[model samples]
Target: MEILDHAFMQRALLAAVLVGITAPAVGIHLVQRRQALMGDGIGHVAMTGVGLGFLMSANPVWVAGAVSIAGAVLMELIRMYGRTRGDIALALLFYGGMAGGVLLTSLSPAGSNANLVSYLFGSLATVSEEDVVAICVLAAFVVAVSLGLRRQLFAVSQDEEFARVTGLPVRALNLLVAVTAAVTVTVAMRVVGLLLVSALMVVPVAAAQQLTRSFRATFAVAVLIGTAVSLGGTVTTYYQDVPPGATIVLLAIAVFVVFATLAAPLARRRARAAQAAQGAHDGVRPSPGTADDVKV
Candidate 1:
């Protein structure tokens, strides 16, 4: 295809697959903790960091990583001790980050808006050699750490209180998780963008949860779904001339809807089977005097 002839598209596809694989690994945990919103929060914060980078003539991705890490840590601390509800804390982060990014962008040179737009919506033309390198390094790190600590992360995710009772270093593990998530979001900006990164981070995991009950199976399936969708979306973008971020995200959502639809009937079947087995064991008959009041 003429699309494959472009080196930029090739790099973008490579970056997309790398990010698609890693984002869901991190996100499966986030979704388990019900912290899937954290990606959106960190992503918004990254925008401010990128804006500051443009102001200072630095690499925006690195700056965004630093800022996103700070934001993630702040969110963890706030959730721990701010006495604010979870939604409120995320909301505070969401607004504060956007406001800061917008203000900083306004104060920058006139042409900086173009850079912000690229960071926000994504640009296939924006993937560079450096971006590819960063994506690979981060992807390796994420996959390694996530698998290495899978049991502990699962312990904490399923029941933080139980994990703490079992002598697990719950707080330390949580901090590590936050930083990892922040780094993933920062690195993912090029593929799906700051505004839409959560879609990729979240939707695949959501779909996986519907299709499987085993946590390990869910994680594996999510990574697979994410990788497949990223490749599909990248190719579709080439042929259709559509936006990469939207195309990828909508595909993930569409996949999730399919899983959800299938899961519903599967769940109903299980429920009915359980009920039937129970009725069979109990002889399907009313007890004692109550039988007189029951229909034949």
Candidate 2:
């Protein structure tokens, strides 16, 4: 309770809450599409934007959002057109973005590896009011795109061919997913850092899937899990004096393990029930060759 008195802590908690909500919101679609690593790629690309913000003495959040959006769009293009060579192209993009960020950060007069470290590993204690505003705005966009258009996004993610046949704009929706993911990366940068942001995006959804059978349930549970961990981790950091990003990620992983463990028994019970039902059906055959049991 005392920690809440500090302006910085208040900002950090707000940012964490937003990260909790937005990360899994967009990530569910990525998971559905089997592109769980897309957030990681966008995080990598966002690094260049962070560097550029430092060099130009501008806000890194906005710069990162712009740069990452471009990178995500490019990645989507590669995915659409690169065909057999998409993986290689993406690898190149990932490495190039990282190298460029390092080089540009070195060129900035006020930027150092130490400053980059904060963004890479998260610096919740340093979150400014402006960052909170940026995060809120970005989070709003992510929520709108990920939730407001969930059916369309889900249709496209589940089956692009089928979605296209159903009159959904598959390519456009895909690009929107990519861009939304990029925005989410920027929104989470201040809370979970770039390197671990993808974990927040993907792990909550993974954890939710362990206990959920439908996409809607998964999305809701993932968001709940994400929120719990984000707030829990942030509060833990205040007491333990640990890295907020690492703490959040580790907490998310812990939740995943718990969900997985609990789900095992539930899954086994479902399997057993299904088997029993089948057995019962099979056992209901006419006994002693009754008239209804005549051979076909």
Candidate with the greatest lDDT versus the true structure: 2
Model 2, TM vs. native: 0.94
Please count the clashing residue pairs in each candidate, in the order shown.
0, 0
Each model's TM-score, in the order given? 0.89, 0.94
lDDT tens string, model 1, 205-283?
9999897989989999999999998888888888888888888999999999999999987887676666656765888
lDDT score at residue 209, model 2, on the 0-100 scale: 98
Question: Considering every candidate listed, which one attains the maximal TM-score?
Answer: 2
List clashing residue pairs in candidate 2: none
Residues 7-122 of candidate 2 have per-residue lDDT tens digits of 99999999999999999999999998999999999989998998898888889899999999999999999999999989999999998888888888889878564388888989
Segments in model 1 whose C-alpha atoms lie over 4 Å from true places: 84-90, 276-296
TM-score of 1: 0.89
Q: Give candidate 2 regions above 4 Å deviation.
A: 282-296
